[model samples]
Target: MKVLHIIPSVAKVRGGPSKAVIEMVKALRSQNVDAEIVTTNDNGKDLLDVPLDILTDRLEEYGNVPIRFFSRFSPNLNAVREFAYSGALTAWLWQHITDYDIIHVHAIFSYASTIAMAIARIKNVPYINRPLGQLCEWSLQQSKLRKQIYLNIIERSNLLHSQSLHFTAEQEREEFHQLGLNIPNFVLPHGVHIPEPIPDAQDKLRQILQIPHQIPIILFMSRIHPKKGLEYLIPALSKFQDSNFAFVIAGNGESDYMNQIQDLLEKHRISDRTHLVGFVNGETKNLYLQGADLFVLTSHSENFGIAVIESLAAGTPVLITNGVAISPMVKEQDLGYVAQLDSEAIASTIQEFFEHPQVAKQKGDRAQQYIAEHYSWAKIAHSLINIYAKYAKYTKL
Candidate 1:
């Protein structure tokens, strides 16, 4: 079966959705299905340079997968919209949709999703839409006025027309009902490819971050955005007078907002205790995870915390706010703490974990075992295949 996965970009820098699509497609191929990526990324190149050398290498790496780069001359700023509306792009996708057994749409509330919606409708093909957390009320409220207009017209129609919807967690599915939007759906968790242990990762990460070997490092590996609750975490870090622990903020986001977050750190007079490492990937990311005493996410609302599960895979306990949809996993696996969104609650959990180091490590071990058994990409891919096969066979193309 040929499965075409649609995402705005396959760029690793775009974070979770890109990573999720890559892992899912890779996993499907391993299971003897012919899977490919159909993205607006055009080799995932940066707008200014659009370096052919780098783009060539990227395409070469995934040579087996067919990539159709549409409208090389389109403006990069609104590439999503441009791609969705382009007659050439629409014609190309419409012509190809019938050749594939399933079209998997990732990240709704985007131009690509609208195009996927249109194509599925015209071709009579079965396409699955993965909201990837955009369906949550809080996420929608972020652009209240604009999204309200978009939803009333474009988004709502696209959603209703899709073959089936895919959710990252049951919480997200339930949240959709609260929004008064109902559609056929499946709940599947994002999966991780467990990385091999880093040699002396703890010491290596400490040295790289200029953190002392004695300080207990708490790691937050995610985009540094306002929705992530970094503003809450940064201030809460100041309240902890204990000198033995340090907070490492790794990841990047909008420049102006990131500067404001930095100013928050300086204003709290805890800048010395906090280190911001721009963005780390591959072994470096694992090193930061292994070096940490614990992992924490204080997001306002998360569809799924892939980072939380990844932290557990690295044998690091996670302390997440209730806003994360995967808090159930934390509870079931005995991972770490789950508190409300307040600064006091976050600080209190950090203190408690520090107070009982042995129990904390035991929880971390249990988390590793749980994620190993449940959240591998192999398991997630199989579930996705089942969801696709259900609609694909019944819909007859």
Candidate 2:
């Protein structure tokens, strides 16, 4: 089946949604599906260094998945840049959307996704909308009135007309249901990419970072934003200051917010124990994952914690908050620890992890098996194909 996945931006800075679609399309292609991606040349403050307005392969430097990068027409202004406006992309989709049997639009409230849905409707095409956690409560609270109006005027109508709403987690789907929109929806989480083994990666990474040997590493990897709840993390790490555990913060964000994190770390006097490493990828990222003792994400609202699964895939346990949608699975499967969104709960749970290091190791080992068996992209791609087949049959009827 010919499928097209449209995302606002596939830049690494965009986090999981970007990575998710790329890995997903790769898996879909491996299954012999004609799946490809289309996105803008939006790389946050800068544009992607790629040939624009045409299909290009190996832009992501991973596999042979075809991705068409269009020039982002957004001005220097951060507000407009975030919109990811692309006239070329819009024109291309307007004329070529019907070329594919199905369309998967990722993210809403953006120029590309919104226009893709509108054009798909106009062209009488079947499309699925993945809000990418935008519809969740904490996300909606960002621009309360503006989003409420946008939903009523533009998004809700588009959703109602679409074939389905694609949600990554049960919690995300449940939150959408509360909107009372009569749209067909399904839950499918993002899959993990199991990395190849790197010899003594843990020790190598520790030496590179100058962290002492045998010290446990608590990793907080994701886009550093207010939503990530770094305030709680500072104090949580502070609770174990005398214990000599290393806290690593991977990922980057706005300078203003990043400075705030620095201040928070200093305020709690855990600055010495914490290492704020800017965006990590490739071998460096894998090393951090492989070496981490606990992967902690104290997000206020997470659609699905991709890093959690990746850490698990690397035989590292996770400690997540209830705000993360997958916390239930993490707890139910006994993969790792789950705690409330406060400092006390997080600190106490972390203490539990350190007290019984053997138990954490056992959990990590179980998590590795669980991730490989269930969270692999190849397996998820098959289920997605089945979903598409079901819809295709309904369309014929």
**Alpha carbon deviation, residue 91, candidate 2 (Å):** 0.9
What lDDT tens digits, residue by residue, belong to model 1 across residues 149-249?
A: 88788888778877788888888888898877767887889998777888887788788878778678888889777889988887777887654787888
**So what's the TM-score on candidate 1?**
0.90
lDDT, candidates in the order shown: 0.77, 0.87
Estimate, for each residue in 141-161, the C-alpha lDDT of model 2 and write its tens digit.
Answer: 998998898888998888888
TM-score of every candidate relative to the true structure: 0.90, 0.96
Q: Name the 10 consecutive residues with the lowest summed lDDT in model 1.
A: 48-57
Give per-residue lDDT, candidate 1, residue 52. Answer: 26
